[model samples]
Target: MIKVMDRLLLFVYSLAVGAASVFAIVMAAGGFDADWLKNAVDDIIGEDALVQTLVIAIGVVLLLLSLRIFIVSFKRSGGQAPSINQRTEHGDIRISVDTVENLALKAASRTRGVKDLKARVRAADSGLQIMIRAFVDGDTPIPALSEEMQKTVSELVQETTGIPVSEVSVYIANVTQAPTTYKSRVE
Candidate 1:
């Protein structure tokens, strides 16, 4: 719903800017000499109190709406990763998403087949969701390796932080080829 509204607002703003640009260009190119354009401008500025008042009101509303749209677009995606909250006897405890991500990376690195790993932690309804993207050796069995990575990352995060992990999704991004070694020949 918010996305739809944002797109609509952007469309409206684009249309307004386009129209204003055309209007300025035409006027600068002697469009006012045309009878229709001259008559329309005269009518708007002709000292009829109601027409002037209506134009001013519309302009003010458009200005306000444009300002609002600009501000909303500027601050659209300023969201931080969610933190884990725990209740302790003395006080509350909070664990940052970074910590969970580090734990996931550590666990994945320990897995045999994983060559490179990247982990992202996000909050979920049950607790946290860990997403791991990994590159492994080409000979590794992807399905089994991914499952092991998922289990390892989930268990390690839960055990280390004492926070429940709803899911650990593993994505095998690539399979790396072993580097070939060249033998030196002395003649």
Candidate 2:
């Protein structure tokens, strides 16, 4: 609702400003009789109470719209990448979450039975919560594979980035099916 109002207000404001600019330009170029236009405007305002109120209201709305635009123009997204902020005696360090996810994927892929792996990292209250969803190859026990993945991801992320990982969750999504290639003797 508010967005619609903002767009509508902007459209109306732009139209009014454009029309006023064109009118002024024409008058200054002597394409219009400036005195007659001025008198017409004066008469419209002077002869009607409703017209005077409407003009004042429009002026107030335009002033408000100008201020709104001016204030919003200064706001910025800062164009900064999302990263984990760290401070030490030397300086500040930032490690992007994407790097962490990549690290997790790399670590999980090292497990023998893990395939089609996807990793997600979320900032937790204490540290980071990592989730790994993988398709298993059925070459190893699920419990052992899950354990190894969790440990590897947690340890690698923590060691490489110096960030504590609060938890690592692994979900074995499915088992992989290998395609068989069979060739028959020539007839």
Candidate 2's displacement at residue 92, Å, is 1.1
Against the reference, the lDDT scores of all candidates come to 0.86, 0.89
In terms of lDDT, the poorest run of 10 residues in model 1 is 73-82
Q: Write the per-residue lDDT of candidate 2 for residues 1-187, one digit (tens) a residue.
A: 7558767778888998999899888888999677898887996679788888888898898899988766656766366867888889999999988999999999999999787999889887799899999999898999999999999999999999999999999999999987788998998
Candidate 1 positional error at 123, Å = 2.1
Query: Per-residue CA lDDT of candidate 1, range 42-135, in tens?
Result: 8789978888898888788678769878788688585765678888899998898888899999999988978988999988779888999999
Q: Once superposed on the true structure, which residue ranges of model 1 sit more than 4 Å away at CA? A: 1-11, 32-34, 47-54, 66-81, 87-92, 139-144
RMSD of each: 3.7, 7.1
- In terms of TM-score, how similar is model 1 to the real structure? 0.74
